[model samples]
Target: MKRSNIRIIGVPEQQEEEQGLENLFEEIISENFPEVGKKKVTQAQRVPKKMNPQRPTPRHIILTMANVQDKERILKAARERWKVTYKGSPIRLSNDFSTETHLTRKQWMEIYKVMQSKGLNPRILYPARLSLKIEGEIRRFTDKKRLREFISTKPAMQERLKGLV
Candidate 1:
């Protein structure tokens, strides 16, 4: 499924000011995404991420963006900048997807990048499948194992994947 907004997750929980979640959200957006600024945000907040304390998953911040361009810019910056921080604490930005979609995207991360670098347009099908145009042919993979097997057989894919991985 397509997401209208991106999330700022893995931000260490912050003490709420008088404005609470809204203030925190604005602070992050203003600092990390100066181009978009606080005015463009439709909504923002911290949400619970259900994970074990043993693992210590940080609380997630959700941002309801004004448009896709703004969202994409923020996500791209987050990806390239790596571990953006606020008040000395590291934060992560991601698409605000359902848990299933998030897991699927994570699983296919490598292949997706490889496909893009190979000059193929790789599109993720909802619920976690990848479809791409490679060598003028459309190829789709619903499973990671099958995708890996396919990559192993193709020398070019194997070489590119090797350099990337």
Candidate 2:
């Protein structure tokens, strides 16, 4: 008997085999799952939506007198008890009722004390003044007219205002 020698052939190149496997896998995925590819394509092509900026709105304010007093006492107290300062210099009260500036807190306190000592109510010594300034988001309601209206309309509010008075 004679012995025979045989040579074995190598499989196809690994790179080519790998590429073929990848192509087969992609074809299988596309055929079996079309929605996945569509979703990926749609997501890739989407653009974000634009948003609009907001504008701030203007607010309304109301004010009214908070107290009433006899004009004579206010004048007298302003003349005799209060001191007005302007530009670091003391202002003098003339007979014509002209002064460089308004009275100070200390002056107002002195006038109040004088009025209290004379057996007169402090509220009756000055005129009522109202001031409004927009601070922020908070709404501060200090309208005397609205307060009076509320007091007139609501018995509870009327009782509360009377207690304050």
Candidate 3:
């Protein structure tokens, strides 16, 4: 018995000829329809002009250093009231000596600075008056005679004692 092998050739050349024929057919169709050869068919479009709307500018209110001072005092009073009511202890002059108390002071100073920068007066609205109710409640638990004596002895606590009175 003899073994024989057959080799194949010219298949790739035939595939290339088929590809060329397809390209020629496409070119003929495009030539017949020129519109098909164009990048796009654009309609007569009208571009509208852009119009900017008018906006109203904001007006600022001016504040003085006296107003900031008043706000600082009010905030200090509020913080003192918070300390007395929540700390489960008697209201004393030394209560304002802690970092917790000083946080409120720092926040108040920040608010004051923001108000000053914005040229807005720190107005004591109805909300601030509502905060005073808590202050009054704390005052009921305090010893008025002792507070008065302490305030007289130390000028630092005078304003806070006055609020209690």
Model 1 clashing residue pairs (backbone): none
Better structure of 2 and 3 per TM-score: 3
lDDT of 1 by residue, 95-155 (tens): 8877887787788888788778777778887667899777889888998778778888899
Ranking by lDDT: 1, 3, 2
Ranking by TM-score: 1, 3, 2
Prediction 2 TM-score vs. true: 0.16
**In model 1, how many backbone clashes occur?**
0
Task: Enumerate clash totals for all models, in the order shown.
Answer: 0, 0, 0
Better of 1 and 3 by lDDT: 1
lDDT per residue as tens, model 2, 32-63: 33333411111101112234357222111111
Using lDDT as the yardstick, the better of models 1 and 2 is: 1
How does candidate 3 fare on TM-score?
A: 0.16
lDDT of 3 at 46: 15
lDDT scores for all predictions?
0.74, 0.30, 0.30
TM-score of each: 0.56, 0.16, 0.16
lDDT of 3 at 25: 24
Kindly list the per-residue Cα lDDT of model 3 for residues 6-83, writing each as its tens digit. Answer: 111112223324444234223322433333342211111111324445732211111121233332443344354553
